[model samples]
Target: MEARVMICAQTFFHRFFMINNIAQQPSSVPAGPKRAGEPEHTPHHMMVAVACLFLAAKVEEYPKFLDDVVRFTYHFRHGKEATEALMADKEGALKVEKDRVLTCERLVVSNMGFDLHVTSPHCKLGPVVDAVLEVAAAEGRTDLVREHKSLLSLATNFLNDSMHHLICLQHRPTRMAAIALAMAEKFMVGKEKIKPFPRVKVDGEMVPWWCSMRIVDDDEAISSDMMRRYMKDFHSQVYRQDDDEAIS
Candidate 1:
């Protein structure tokens, strides 16, 4: 019964939260400064508050930590604000007591669980390349298909250690494949590299700059049906442009 409740909660919350995220306008830029007249407990405040909460969850068995308030400060200031801003609001009037911050952090932890990690296209490069290959095969674009496959492998290799920055936790195989595919499409269609090829310390390793049309069949393999489901789910859950229309 507890397990069932957990599953149900996750499903309902995931649906609503994803829909809400979709409804918001997509911004390539980092979040902007808050309006001057924004209220104390406004959504922006809640966003900062939620970061504190997630930090508390990370420390406790729950989902946040007391120190997350400082983390929020770092994010807000982008390492530019004075330390005093860590204690009070921008106007220096609304002070956040440490105890209150801890309490809110606990509240956030209870709400979000300790699962802070999320999936991105970095994870799905493999399957996306294969999917593109299938599409390429259908189009009879052998050169383009092979090019995409090569790019897919290169992107996946580039991400091996960098995935830590993308998700911050252990890799989930299914999500990894989806992210890989999306990345492959981005490169193949855009005809550009998303990031510089990662430097290798090992004596013998393939480098993206030196290689062309190198085939990696194992990289194309998807592990399970669940992985495919996760890939599609993550794409739908996270990457829609028109939030209101994207959720449905």
Candidate 2:
């Protein structure tokens, strides 16, 4: 469920960025620029983010009530005291906020051209993990089979962490799955919990374990160096956030 929400949020932000870029483009017809302060013309970021999450929940088949979404959004954006006061108001602020969210939802859908289907790397993680384990078993490496749960958990953690960075936007789902598995295997090997991944024979040539998974075609084959570069960037982002939190 968390994975689904994260994937949806990533898709929402991606579409949001695209919409902003298109909106900023110069119009062919000469017209006065709308004032940024206009209430109708300017949508609040919080409202749009909540709307995206609301729409994403529906898309992921985990529908949430709009009222619950709005309430939670307010609770998170404002503190408990402020939200309670707003909810108690007779001026219909909550109703107005709900209306704004609905309006933004339409804007989001229109800007997205009604394309809401989003494929997540989480879906690919399972198959990738299975392929690796199958190869390990084929090589008479029973140790990996025994550690299946741990391996899957580590890979899942890596994949979830990847969602926090723009690396998801930079790579396809298949590539992200491969990277997650690679990171997991590397971490396990570093801890001496498992032997390094065994190479598999592919078309008479020995190839890395990921090569057997068919994550990408030969033309789009990723190299070890490339994987390392991606992992480095991923770690940097994660650690940078940790440092910021520590300072805070």
Candidate 3:
């Protein structure tokens, strides 16, 4: 259920690849003291947001129709009150949006040095969740195995929400997947009174950079607690955007 909600919402912005941190991109760029004259076009927030949605429908395997994506995104951006004019004049709206999408897509593709392949954490979900469960079982914690299905749901939601942050790109899909599971475990322990086990660490990989970005004390694979902190920090960024949007 959570997965479906996220996948549907994500249909708009398939890959919002922003190199700049959310802290750098404010809702409104304030005028500063004049520097050497320059205003070269870079992909801004709205452009990247819409383009990701437009492109995702085409690129993702299940293939939502272009019309569905357009309408879905429109409602997502502007609540769910669509009138006849909005629905009837789809072509006109889409033509304008497509132009914006094209410009942003080109800039993003080029800006990232043409690394068009944007990896999503969805694929690595199974192995990551299994690792969590396996760790639990090894620790003689059958309670986690008993609630595996719910934890899987929680993990899916966490990964989906995590995608809202540009920091996701700094980590590999596998690392993102593992982080999602760790986050799920944290929620599971706190919400359901599940016995908190010792933090399970992934043996091989170094810690993801985002985890080290003041979220963790040292460079290490994020444990359950570190991931919870990371997500708390991450969601605050999303909330900031939401607040700005509401005001604007």
Candidate 4:
């Protein structure tokens, strides 16, 4: 069974690998005159956000339905909740904000040259996980390593969707990778989901039942915090390192 699963996975990756080579690169902001107070960005970073969606659909093979993308992008940019949110709010009558939606779509299309296809980081993330697992095995940390591998995969899946509207993919991968790994390790240590840890009631607030676990001690938390901090600090280091090497 394991061998069959592995073979299937390999075949899937091989197909994706061939397609990934020719498809568009990841979505990026397009170049434009820098706004006041904006840091200068590379041409690649400046590709319009809409282009990112184009890339995602092509790469993930799951394009956001056109209407859904336009509606969500407008709602997201304008801070207008869709009908569902307005229905939930009893304060005022809900009307479909057609003008706002139309304007947003036009702006996005104009900025992105109406191109909706692009490459996605998801294509590259698999190899990264494999490398992480290899390192984990070398260090004899199988328990924590396996947990981390799962966390990375989950985080990557989540980001594949989130990247549609985002400019930076750096932060999510780092922060989520750490958080997921920590949670996984907590689960592995006899802190079974069956006997959850005790929850202290904070005044007027209900903590979720699942979050009541005593996952990390204070000392361990410090290490975890340091790991997170390192990821945060290192987020843009890759870009900078490449620039430095180019100059050299």
Candidate 5:
């Protein structure tokens, strides 16, 4: 359930960033002098993130209360004592925080042009995984079928991890889904295991199984080198924090 909500929230943030032309901005941009009537301060990233989650909950039909969203976000950021104080409305801080979130929500809505629909890669993951497994099984890769649960779980984890990065924004939903499944297969059964799945001839060249599945258009077709690069970045970037947490 949380995963579903986060996926929606991530998509919302992606769209929000794009709409505001902030997606490609460098990490730190120098602020220009303020103009008359311009806001004294912009919304903090934390505030925007919380607001995105709050709005995404509604868009996804999960519908968490605003108070709960504010409270949990506060708790996650500031720890138990601060959350308790905020909940108790100490010095009217709770009201102030909620107001900030509301303001950010309005900003997000306005910038997004009120378009709330988000197509998540999770929607495409299931069918692609099933198709791949079916093809593998037909080719006598029975182990993949036997380990279906693990494969699916790992693939789903990849999809979830993708939310933390710009990967979803960089690739189409179907391509992301197919790459996630392929990554899962490589991790579970080794690279050689994937070679048995039949490829399709596209314009005198053989393409991977996913390309034939129409997971990506002919022009957007993924190459083996590209897959390797994605996998390399996924390992180096996405799972870096997980590795650190495990180490500590």
Candidate 6:
């Protein structure tokens, strides 16, 4: 169910910009957060995810009725609710959740400092990929770069999927793009790329991604090992069984 909500959240982000001119949507003015008690009936994570959908609707201006969003979310989350009508008279719980959604929306909008414009993975990651390629070339890995002609595109694809997870909100777009690109490069070149990088205490006996990727960008502040750790944590996140259903 979280997967479905996450997909919807990503959809809301994309759909908003798609409906509006790609660059025209203004950053949401800081409207300030609402002070409401955490919803007791539904999981806090569920409310937060739903709130993202509701907030996206308003910011993008293709407002989805709160009722529709509620029913849409509950329907997939609960198999029994799958056939339920959107009508308000059927059950008052939908209305309650609607209020929760609105409240949470306010909290999210305020927390985000009202920024609404979403960055494309390409735009966000292009520089990172270019920098990595430049580093590879300088390190005499141009042979590998030339062999992987579609490397950047492949990395972008991985970023597209990574955006489905909540990490986008947690980390900088460029950082995620870099990690995705590193992973792509790793896929193309086996462990042969691993170099002896500065070890981070725990991996003293093990070869970390930083050692493997030869990524030594000080500005990025994340070692390949840390990036690999993030990747491990990210992939370990709970995946929703109903993800494809939501996207479809």
Better of 1 and 2 by TM-score: 2
- lDDT of all predictions, in order shown? 0.41, 0.72, 0.55, 0.37, 0.71, 0.54
Q: How many backbone clashes does candidate 1 have?
A: 23
Query: Could you give candidate 3's per-residue lDDT for residues 23-101 as a string of tens digits?
Result: 4444642222224665543445655665555554444544555556556666776566652345676567555555556
- Decoy 4 TM-score against native: 0.31
- Cα lDDT tens digits, model 2, 1-248, are 35697578667766676557535433331122234784343344555678788888889889888878877778887789977876786257767776767777888888888888888888888887777777788789987888888988998888777776667777888888887778788878778888888887777988776665463322377766787776676666755542211211
Clashes within 3 Å, all models in order = 23, 0, 4, 13, 0, 3
Q: What TM-score, computed on C-alpha atoms, does each candidate reach?
A: 0.34, 0.80, 0.58, 0.31, 0.76, 0.49
Residue by residue across 1-248, what tens digits does model 5's lDDT show?
37678898888786677655544443431122235896444455666789899998888889988888988888898899988987997448777777768878988888888988887888888887677676677777776777778778888888888888777787778878777777776665454443344555667777787656453433466778787666666666677642322211
**Ranked candidates, highest TM-score first:** 2, 5, 3, 6, 1, 4
| C-alpha RMSD of candidate 2 | 6.4
What's the distance in Å from true for residue 60, model 5?
Answer: 0.4
* Model 6 Cα lDDT, one tens digit per residue, 133-220: 6655666765556654566766667666766655555555556666666666665555444332223233455444333333333243
User: Which candidate model has the greater lDDT, 5 or 6?
Assistant: 5
Model 5 TM-score? 0.76
Instruction: Give me the runs in candidate 6 sitting further than 4 Å from their true place.
Output: 1-43, 60-63, 80-91, 112-122, 126-154, 160-171, 191-248
The runs of at least 3 residues in candidate 1 whose Cα sits more than 4 Å from the true structure, single-residue gaps closed, are 1-82, 85-97, 113-176, 179-183, 189-248
Task: List where candidate 2 sits over 4 angstroms from the true fold.
Answer: 18-42, 213-219, 236-248
**Model 1 C-alpha lDDT per residue in residues 12-44, reported as the tens digit of each score:** 234224324424523321234334895433122
- Pick out the ten consecutive residues of candidate 2 with the lowest summed lDDT: 25-34
TM-score of 3: 0.58
Judging by lDDT, tell me the better candidate of 3 and 4.
Answer: 3
lDDT of 5 at 169: 84
Number of the top candidate by TM-score? Answer: 2
